[model samples]
Target: MRRQPSMLYLRPFMPLIVGLSLGFTLCLVCLPLLEEGCTSEGSVDQVARLRKPNSVQETQDNPKPAKSGGKQPFRARYISTELGIREKLVVGVITSRETLDTVAVALNKTLAHYIHKLLYFTGTRNVKAPGGMYVVTHGDDRPVWEIAQTIRYINDHFHKDYDWTYLVTDNTYVQGERVTDIFDHISMNRDVYMGKRVPFRDMDGYYCKVGITEKDGTQAFSQACILPLCRGEDVCLFVCLFVTMETILDLQPDEWLGRCLHDVMGISCVGEAEGVDYHTYEFSSTTDPDNEDSQEFQKAHTVHPVVEPTDLYRLHRRFAHIELDLLYPPIQTLNPCFPAQIKNLSHKTPEGEAGLTWPIGINPPFKPQSRFDVLSWDYFTETHLYTCPDGAPKCELQGVDRQDVDDIITTSVQRLNDKYQKQGLTFEHVRLLNGYRRFDPTRGMEYELDLLVGETGPDNIRDVVTKRVKLLRPLSQVEIIPMPYVTETTRLYVILPVTVHDREQVAKFLDSYAQVVLDIHENSALTVVFIYDPLDAQNIQEEDVFGMLKSMITYYERKYPNAKIPWISIKTDVPTQLKIMDIISKKHPVDALFLLVTVTDELTIEFLNRCRMNTIAGWQAFFPIHFAQYSPELIYDTKPYPATVEFGKEFGHFDVHAFDEACFYNSDYMSTRTELQKQRKENEDVSETYNLYEMFLKHSNLHVFRAVEPDLRQRYMPRTCNPHLSEDLYHSCLVSQAEGLASKEQLAKLIFEHDNEIKSQAENVVKS
Candidate 1:
């Protein structure tokens, strides 16, 4: 009787009983709890979700927040890009033993550090080294590989990250053979600009045969017609970043050049604060009260690699490429990107029959360009240079000008000596401008290109020289910054601003763009990985930005069915303990996730690979870290979104939360992507949207606002004091009331108190 096993006999009937009773029992017990879990307050009432069906089969799974740690879940800014990114760009030092290697690592690391920060915020830098050599570039105009290097380094090393393509470089890439050569190649050829020569009565010594006739060949009034007929068009600007510890014993001048370019030379290039009478880094030397009070920022510059002890011609040589012609160069049709000019031809293809002249020419882009005079070989070749032949000296040959050589013989030495002679200098002063000769018949052209093989050609020399030629140094600490590449509206800002009249509404999808869009793996669509967003003023509370982001993401996955997606929302605001607390206060309104829970047992508390950390492919929810049991779909919330109480971690906490979705074909999501996009003339009658007045009205709902006081934060916490000390001060503060902790009206009242403080801070930061 005891062996009947408490209902063992019923166990025999258990199959049928379970078949009959379990559904009803679960429906009665589970349905009520789950329905209440989702519909409750302070949750991301995401898009499509489950309603109480008639039976247990439709019950929503509910997982509880892990009790181990006090952590606030994130409001995911939904970002998706189908990618297989290998998160490392091994920047090998390629240095000698321990010491130099350490220096290399430190310099590169410091460079990488500031570059990451600058790019994350401004998306720009003043100087960039796309390859081994340093380069000075406007943030917007940096070479593609340099931009990629910055993006990849940011993605791999920083807590907040970014990504680029395997090969998106246009100017240079792979650091192969020093891509700086490209600039040198472009600058080699030059125009022959002539100016009326001045008499050498004041300046004498440089020798040249001067025989001249007057304007009318009267009175014998002679002057050297100083015409600079430059032909170094193939020349370029290249440089070396000199690095050094002690030039006397250890560092060579060039090494110091390298080090300066590698780790320094950022702020020094421009005068501080526009016209501050101090060195760029002069704010330091605080304890050195006896130090000289500063005045008038000196141009930031490098002192090494001079042709003479006091001469800066080595740098000048590089600078000359740009300095040669303050006026824009004669545009050549071959240089496609340059603007059109009479010389840099306005059109490659001539417009329809422009007042036909005698000696009719074929329309350009054929043989012998239609623009230049056929009789004047020099004009045809030098001005409208195309895929055509203008024969003269070698009229026997193709496109050769025999008279061109004769013109060169007289013009060559005189042109070289002209500009230099005015300054009492001569041909020897020019490093690469050795004498030239006619192009031999052996090669295909009229000019034999000679690269003085003693030393290899320079790379990024112009940029190197540009930044170095202007250093305001000898005072203050140094910092390097990255060049800005992405636009403010386009970066993570793409998804940050969207106010749903109700978070309690079912769900709304938001879209984000990448700094550089990588190709989608399978479909015609792109795999755009969003790297960051400014901290949402609203997300500071409940960080369920992590959650709201989930809905937008569910939307993208649905809309772009064939494209795979991965995304993370990086809150750019630094945080404090109170701020972190504000985030945790509001738990998930509904936390249904596509989690691979099996990995939970092994997660190291604060490791970077945790489910919520930022990366090119979102957080690293690796195999074991994301899963718990061997459950196939171990989710506890409804589909498309989550339950408020279900979004937290069970055994481990993370900087981010992982959400998985197979959600597709969502009509709701599509509507939002095109929300602001106008469809047609018929819709023109629709009322205007995005008005400041409406924004003011919408923002009147104070409960959702988050504020910050800039003056207080900046004065207290700056890594400039001791970068490693602690970032406690930089953290954000959440002043709003906690979810479930306060009524909406109560929260609104508290929010308004800080609104003024926030508004003033925003204004001050802009002013500062």
Candidate 2:
């Protein structure tokens, strides 16, 4: 019927036939290599894999290991110890109906791998939960009560099969590897209830305390004193339980579980302790905005309320990268065909340590490598804290004596009372109620104290009435620590020097700024300053440009009423921007920062923080190297060009060093202008070519040159906005004819060889 099945019919299955033949040939090739009497218990999987090369294989327990093998796709298997943990532990993600989809995404991204017995529970009925999660029939509206019922269900069912149960919310991100290690030390038989323990207060303002007692009802632990309640009622479900709608209604799902467990299982809520310390809570997502760098985030067993799907992915990606690096360290080259050779294998016996294998010549076969070694407790348990360097100026009162602080507070209160009496003020609460310090190095100190003094009645000591008084101290001997003023929260100011060519350019600029403002407003206290001349716009009306700018600002202000969106617009020449900067820096708070960027530049929150940290008052500045794009004419041209294009490909010549657009500096770094003026007079030849970046580097005490990856790609501005030229034609003419004239690699190599010479030349210029 098909003329004996022609070559065309077999062409579709050619890849499959070739793949099978190759796999079979490799197995045949490998089988003869193993010498006689070389077989051992550890070699079974390897032999099996060779015999049936095309067989579908599942990892013994951890089926889907979260190992990122980029070019090498072979995953290291889980060890016996890690597999045992997977069999014993069960994780339940407690979620509400509204956040189920978000929770599912989080679980799949982070915890789905390695955790064998993963389950999720919600309160909505008749709704299909993804990944075979559980759903309850009732109590969907009351999420708090639903959580209580969920716990009871877990304890009833899971305690028999699973040794430990960890319940977290949909938004919580649990570091599974860290959690398992913590559970290894904890005993399932013991009374264990662990979370971030929050002190609970009743409707009547009485604190709830948990008292330990013997089985016979005698108190075994000291009890915290309870405050008196306004309406005394019998709300005790236990020995001391205060329940009210005003109080219990606001209890979060975690708090509700803690209370429910105390009543049902008779165990108190506990936190970090000896041999078991893993739980830490953060109520918000902590992700680095620019690079999604996990190193910047606080190290904890769990980070909670990572509500955004994107944030969950960020945390997962970074954490997975960390694990992958630990497993296959970058120092060692990995082989795709063979198992990784692990040097520090955990299961080595003393005999094996003495270079003895089970068989005569072969080394003991590799079992699936364990990610965490036996002595890796320190890696998981050690806490990382930020500390100021010794001999550095610290903001806190670190070395000062405690008694001296007490004496100062007491003396300041007395002086305030004396002033209050003279002023005939009825504010009698002049005693030291509370006090805090904020430091300004320029001014000595300003201590803001809350003083309380009362007029006692003759009848009873308890009848004494008090009034609150706020005082600032400049009293005879006591010095004050000045705090930041309310209006001085903004630390960085961005200055934009713009030239508008057309309505299209203006629109693009506004759109870019709007996105930047949205990204930064929540996290940063900063302002934007626009420096441009109205007459510079050759295509659009100056008035229309101003109106557009105003509209953008107004829209943001109305949408985010609480956030202060400060935009300062100045119509001036480009050189005048520096003078405005000098004026602003002189008046702004100490260590206030400034940045220079074009209107087209997009900024990230991470870069802004980097700007703040790198720039120190009168000391250092950041002059970031930028990527200069190649000519658009060569890019869009159908004909061959002089140099090869490297824009999107690996090792491709896309960007080159020409101009730097971004500079970050603090108030004290304004010596740039002064130094430039001196240089111009001293050596007129070099002054004309000496740029702002070079001047900043020469004047500042310390200068850091960092390359901005995914750099600020400035839009091309034509020499003239000619009415005859079309938009596309104008773009092509913007790039100079000399550009794309030579290979980028040659230029890069030349620069690299002469880097030292260039530095020496700069130094010589400074000396002159």
Candidate 3:
């Protein structure tokens, strides 16, 4: 004969025996009442009791229904009023050594308020924990066995009492009110299963979702267990797993329960396609705290894999805004008679301060980590790590065009002339050094203008003066008097070419440039311009480039609000070197220092200051030879990616011949380059085509200073090495792994020693 299922033992004449005993006892009492001429009300009560027991009578805690002649309407047991949903729901929390504290936090703050018949299951013996938590198990660590025993215990003790039962791991967070609301319309008679559903390994069935644990850069994707919803008796039917345990030992508990209930009892998951199973939010170590008041969080019934005890309490406080009448407190509290000590913990006290919701004995008092912290942290670390001063206000620089600051510059320059009218130092022209508009929370939009005022002497010679002023715009449409401060500062304009192919590299450079400018004192001025060819944007749409720039601008503005790092973008037919220089000359004054570079080049504050101090307007120019990195194919030849270069050797040697890639020149010298370009464009048939290095050599009248800039480095191409080269020099041809260079003192000393030799040689000749 086929073996009967283990669940069949639950119904072995127990129902029949209980029914016969209740009927016999009621009849004996009713006969005595009839002989005593019982009133019509008493007789009606006797007949009502004699009828088949109603749903209310099934649970001892639920109140009796009103007297009625017809049958009562079908009501889901989960929808309760007398004992409320708190008593109707039973939660069995599965815990282990790893999750005891987290489980305690959940029970203390959240689950204890919504579940009365709560049970804790830990299969291990001799575990020290708070009393009335550890359920006795047969010393089996398997989740399948734990789940079976929990269901069997619920069926035997709380059979037909609670309408719903939930079995979840300690890391899972249950929003009790949300679960009740989801099943408010479901009938108690129907068997229901709920959780995040995913395909079981190679099996046709689906099981509740599990999470992965990532530790020390390693990942372990373990299967977790969750059994939710369904009545006590209905869930007990899953204990039949003992009969087929051998064939299904590999299955997770949730998967095993899903298969058994579906295959044996013909019950399919009535969990709605978009219900709790779909709305659960699973968090890991790196997840942000989702807002509880949002509509998405309100719909989610549970949050899983909340392994930290403090995080569990934080989530509880978020959802604790709702005040549900706790008609039935849990049968077991973490501490005995704990409720009497506090009376009742709710959102408000009788005297009405904040919620007296602090849990006892939990370490590190709750501090709110609001969304602003996250937003600001992300802004600072968007591309690189940055440290913000303590108690700094959140601020961002709003991008503005020339027209927006034209009036501010005009007004500020006029104010300066009025202040110095008697001294005969007249301010002639106002050039925008780095004027920017910023939005202040307390005040409306205010303007900070860093204007370069051109002061003309009596001899008609011109010199630049820098004046910084802050102006307040009020609601009365009145202009406030500007406060001015003057300082002698170097002004630099950086130019670079960007394309769709170099978007990522340009983004990294932009971030690094933002950091570089942070080291600049308030007196210095910096602006950057990126030129791109509209026709050459091949890989991505032109709009994508605009979007990337827009986001990066917003991020940097928020992080370094006071630092004047202005940026501009131009679209041209071709971003040629001569064309870019011409654009700069037209927009900026002749004295504005210009440094042309590529996206792969690294920059520093010292290098920028060197360009400013070394390059004299019209008298001298700086042509820095940059250090280049090695080729990946040469160093990691035939090896896999991330291969290391030769030990103790950094990549690349300084190329003394490379001067065209990075150059610092004034607009007067740029005019000569423009003339060369114009001549080339006109005379195409010329045999001798002069390149940039040749142009530098031809302009011998200007003292063109050349030196190796140790701080500046550039990337090398793939074929930078040759196989015929000696093996001793092979290390220089491999990809660079240089995170940092030699100390600043060391590099500065090396550059000074080399530069003095060149300076002495240049003095002997008419150098350019």
Candidate 4:
């Protein structure tokens, strides 16, 4: 080089010299044409045109050299240029009638230009399928049939001109520009398909676990020529196309298409063993693009399973302005490129067979342990000293030791003291009582405490008093037990009228009803009163009526020896019935009063329990009375009134009326009924006597608890309201004369039927 530059050293400059000479020759060729057709001004325009074409063509065909005067090799430059640009591709969308209204509409607006055709399949022939879309009818509901038909339709209609066929559900979301950018590195002329990839092992595990297997205990598939067809519709579709193609690009391994190809079609996806230029994404059903993760959004080419129509529109607006240059770094700042190593691939033997072992030093998600630390306490022997309200020893002791109990009590007291101290108040002496513990069936464990509160501290300022403190525990750790008997104060008075024709029927009704009354035990008291017509007493004999009523009390007393029975019988007419009611009200006030016109219905234990619990909860007014047909056997065959009767309407007439006979009134409410009856008689338009009483109660603003039990209604038949019967006769007269009184066996069967109904109802309440 020091001596002189050789020919080889100057060779690189020859191409520039040759390019300049070519440009000069092009100008020379145009000089004759320019001179013959132009003046001096026009000749400059002709020369400019000749230089511009040559310069532009050369710039487009060649790559600029680096500052070091070295140009990229010819083959490398050609490959890089080809990878950077791609021809416009045609895309086809497959949808169905079910999704056409939601997903198809979104696709039409978002990817209209890219869409070659929108193919919709439906089973119905009269759908009046939309115009400008291809519609296919095949009576099958399976997705496989629709997919297969769509492929055939595209091939036949488009003449194999499409670059890519994106098979997607109506719910999938895609960006047309992003999809185009992903294909830039891909060669469309080659046999290539890109989608999410799924592994074979994962798919096989899911199918085997779900019991989708064959007689040989392996995953099952339908027969399709020599190759077995996969169960998944998407898997089958891509595989069918793969059989005719060379290279299949699996985009996402976790998604359906990739899973199917690997598991069902026995295809090894590309990305699992190599790095890919394009990115695959799956947006969760719960994701919203307005608050999406920025890093995740930037990496994705296609986001799948976006079923929401609003999200599809939003996704389109986000990437509509994104240019391909923004997605990659600037060329001047770019580092030398290197191929990435394969990720998450299984180990292979020297012979290329997949090995059973994974990479060393890998850890499981969690550490294995035999036992876990839970909040537990040590039980003491003294815990067994507690007794139930009945003085019966509790079966089990779920309590902590003395030290722990003392610590809990001390901590609780300290917290209370600290809170009051902030308000310039403090407790004096605090002491645990004789260590007495009691078990409340409903409230769980409790302890008796003795404490003194005064400003003088503990210096003879106050006396120590006892108080009950509920033993506290986590609700999850508590076990609840049903109380053996009701404990709340509940009283019910049943008023009934007995007549000559129905004296025996009334006795039977009282007999069965008393069984439910006795079940209430010491928690509640019941008084049953029988009213007899003085006129009917003359024919039936008063002693006989009294004897029948007394017999009912004797039967219940003997049956429930432990329960207290209180009952009385009085002789009265309609006018004097209210007077008798007043006398009984003063003698033994009740929580509720029930007027029984007929005793054809059975009462459930649950209803009786609810009555007691409601009373305890301060419900003192109306309790809902459900109605049923007069005949039990006809209940299912005949329809019931849809609603409670409105004011002044007869039963079964307007589908809304009071259940006069079955209604329960607060004892205080019943006491005010004498004045209501007086008001009713004073009104000039007294077409109906029964419903007027209900209207009076409604105006009083009394609280009404809806205790309508459908099961109870079936057993409790409605009072006979036949207009054919004499109005003067007691309502029970019709019931007594009515045939088909349920025998003891039938009554037992009714109780059994209600048992399951109540249990299921309780479970639903607890769950809710």
Candidate 5:
């Protein structure tokens, strides 16, 4: 029985024995090969042999002893030999169908050079993948949620470890080398986020409801309170990271990310922190072209709101180099190249050319050099002396040659029509008339033209005409009157309260007032209604003051014949003043009224021009002028004053305040003046002058505009002093003008100094 079982039953064990025998034989045969360092295919030895040498391999078997007090060698693994910090960065750009192509071009031009791995997540698969671009399709179109989902998807699908993940919008432009440098000291394992930060409370009130429920069962922010907190999409993505992944973000308050993070999440960003340098730029839409050359721009790691392709290209060209120190030197040490000053010289007769000269024995006429000088003339002139040939009283022609005057008028009308057309304005009809003041025989018989334009609405056509007319006839002047058949021009009737002290103390201001008339004449169809207050007429007799003022008006009228001048005398009595204003308003249906309490203060040409432009563009019903008041000592200083010397400091350092001299009353507001006066009379405790503007502001909706530019300190001077005309009025007026001029001179000097410094620096840099 044992013999019969051995032959056939041992078949399974025989195969196992053969396999063991074969393995034993193979090991014996490979022993010699293993000793010789020969490795077989698909073996662990083969894999080890194929791998490149370690970057920090020991040259000898034994380690070298360290010198006493010497620093220890870093044992950290090198991820890449060529790309240090860049090797760890993985940038993910969030874009949509609308901006996918634009973002692709921008990334390909800028960040694509240094990024270890670049991914673009878009809403749809409508885009064709570019040559080296990794595009991922997402179901969501919203950038806020999509950014979060994209990061999560990358982390899940991609098994490779990435030290940093940068999430940015399509408009974000990154300087890759700058970014690497910024994050060089930062640990890769830390949950670091970098971007601009904004406060939640500073955002618009509508986004105050968005918030998360804390673990304590109370909502961090209720639904109703999210509106004011919620920020723009540019900011929301940064906040999403903290919600989705417990990320510690380094927020820059100056950047879009910080603005969004703080605005939406009530998070305060640090100006400086570990692992982050706040060097991001949220470039303003109105950024000056010169800002691109600034050190801040050179050092910027990321610049946001850069949607334009040209801007992306420019940034790329600027930051492509590796010379960080040379490119981004400290601004304090670097001298900026100042722009060359272009001197605007007045027109002059060419050398050896015959010019017009005053005829012998012909008086040049009485020209008032000072406000105190009274010209012997009348405000109202005879109509027959300057009437048009067509018998229209409003039309006047002044020239020795009638045909030549007619030809000039015709040319001016045509030119005006063309000018209006070029400015995108259309006129229903235009009529030209000739004007004659006292003619200068030597100046080829002086003449002027008046244009009557009919349009559908109020427009800045008058401004255009005034500018062009001056070019056409530098010796003459042109007036533009918007007719009733055209759109109604809003008339600003200015009421100036002039005291006798004002006449003596602020004579320079009176001279400056003539400029206001010129501004109104050139820019708008308006009138000035000066109301002289005789109560404080102590410096000069009331009659003499009135006569002097009349003379001044007559002088300006003759000089600017097209200008309309209407004025009346009023007692200091408020009731009497109100009656006179009412009468004036009835006679001329004014669209607005201004009460100039500070009669010495002059309305600048810039302010008047702005008012005209705003009105033409579409003015509000109740518009107020925001003005400033400057100190007399500061204004009149002959020595250069520092820019740091705060303006309007004497008036509580406020740029705007309750200044009656700065108030403007619209048509609706002018109607309420009677009620305001009544209220003032009933409540004697209220200041009549101060309460007038305040009452209108409180009762009605106001649309205010800053009439004066803060940079122009001369414009801030009030026409009259606080207590009528103060004793220091003249000193202040003169000093302020001198200070303005001195400031300009000082600025020029500073520019020259800086230019010299820049030249020296350039020479040093070259020598080095």
Candidate 6:
């Protein structure tokens, strides 16, 4: 069985962290500075709140990045302890490139259609590299004035609270036809469509969502996830384009580009691209300051469809608006021309030289391999050593079937590294990825893994492993503790064989499984078991395997309590009921846990080793989501799906319509607050009116520091809510992954596939 991709990107905000206790989450209907402080009653956020809001309350002058030298219309405000005030400015990761890459191409095409035709984003094209990608307008065209107009218009009509948003573009290896047309049309007539979905539909709302993880650069799709919670006319979209700028002696990245366009820029695009005219706000691009300490508040916009328009808006602003420096206006204003003439570390700031990668968007935090990963895989395969298929990457081992992956990888690296040893830069950063074998189930499985710590050669098992381990992290500060929550309750299937009995007498054997559920540790809510009657089974009680499972669970529990082995039994030897095993597997999507007794005279069992392997892989893929929310325990029954026949004096059934207007009309203030309470629940802060953060809660025990509390499930669901999570994460994670693929120098396809497969499995289960 192929490993399933993760539902890690499935972020359902309405069901996971909607807390009665927490507050201060950004209304991510867009992205950035993902801090969730304890805001006032109106909102609830889960992340850390970064900074205070602008001091000037009447900050009406909005800086038109497109126009250059002007004040912005709105100043972001929130509750801040640093200022001892309510109106503070919070920061969080908006949609990022890595976040965008996971989105499938079909969704990308659909969204491209949405934006291109409406906005005239122009011909969507792709620039590909071995480890990078870029998707943007075919020819050279920027979105400055059009985005400016978009920003101004949105402020004038929709919302005045936030004037800044990120516009994330999609990552596409292939851009289908009609993408540009749809994008262009949307740009001109954004108001034609309601929201991302219709206003009153039972669908996803327009919100910018990002999955934040402290796990740095470990290539796993599950590490970062996202969902959409933003809607807008302006977008700070960050585009990821391939980097092929070796001519400039700059290998910035393989494929990436930061294509920004705010609502202001989109409006500008309308004029320049489509000749649409709107009243231009009398705004200069100068940001005035009275010597407040201001730092470059970095807000990233990843390009992808199904994202908060915030990133695209940013892209619009960055390119079409003004020089990038002004965007980082300090609260304590610093001259863009710093005392020493400010320049970025990469020397690519506004003053720095622009190059082929200028349009490419490869930002910092180059994912250095982690220490855990570096030492996690050691050469520990003592199983078999053999050669691969004839003429296929020729190997020199013994048996053809027994292959040593380490040998193959080692040889490849040695040959390649030897050829490039003359290069000056130390080849210390890169190494081999271990954990590359499947243990045989024939013998008791003892899985052991080790990360390469360096010392590899081209002809060796690996080209290189970590030789010099960097001790950079502050060991004193880094502490870890595991908090176990009530995870999934186990399911049990019993296999009781028929002895000296015909098929009709099988009910007597089936009745015992019901008794088993009642007999096992009842007080523990962590366990649930189901009994199955197999259609193709023939065996007696002693000759059967049902009794062996009881021993396995009993033995495994004592051995690996953490494994949480659940149980299920299959009763075989019945003539017709034997095929039920396939039905149960199909419906529950449960890995083949039940033992199928093949016939009455003898015992034939398909142990389902592959299913077990995939099941375990699925467990890891959704490790975050598994316990992140509540999942109803699914059980297979020997009996058919029983339909409840309700006898009522008056027959009643409600057919729900999409976007029902009646629900809102009947809602009272209390009901509205309740609904808002579910949607925008800010955690405890410092005050009743503005802040709700409780110091104790803010300084939570690190062990319980789930970004989205595992116990909390109301506002947005966790990666596990495949029903909700799959839909959201699928849309969000894949989009972000697309961005990552386009931008990240060396994209990790392994991580993407793992995450995608997990979600696919869950989705197939849901669909089936």
Please report, as a residue range, the 10-residue window in candidate 1 with the lowest summed lDDT: 215-224
C-alpha lDDT values of all predictions: 0.26, 0.49, 0.55, 0.46, 0.48, 0.27
Model 5, 683-747: lDDT tens digits are 55333243334445554444444343443233344333234322343344344444333344455
Top candidate by TM-score: 3
On TM-score, the stronger of 1 and 3 is 3
Please, what is the TM-score per model?
A: 0.16, 0.29, 0.29, 0.26, 0.26, 0.22
Off by over 4 Å in 3: 1-87, 131-138, 200-205, 210-249, 273-278, 290-298, 320-768
User: What is residue 440's positional error in candidate 1, in angstroms?
Assistant: 21
Instruction: Give the candidate number with the greatest lDDT.
Output: 3
Candidate 2 on 667-721: residue-level lDDT in tens? 4555666666665666453322344455566665555455554434444323342
Candidate 4 per-residue lDDT over residues 244-292, each given as its tens digit: 3322232221233334434555543343112344455556766767547
- lDDT (tens digit, per residue) of candidate 1 on 102-173: 332333333343231222211245422332322223244222223323333433453222221111111100
TM-score of 5: 0.26
For model 2, the superposed segments whose C-alpha errors exceed 4 Å read: 1-86, 131-139, 202-242, 263-266, 279-286, 289-298, 325-768
Tens digits of per-residue lDDT, candidate 3, 68-105, equal 34444466655653344334466777776555645554
lDDT of model number 5: 0.48
lDDT of 3: 0.55
> How far off is residue 215 in model 6, in Å?
32
Q: Rank the candidates by lDDT, best first.
A: 3, 2, 5, 4, 6, 1
Model 3: lowest-lDDT 10 consecutive positions: 215-224
Give candidates' CA RMSD values in order: 38.2, 28.7, 31.9, 31.0, 34.7, 32.7
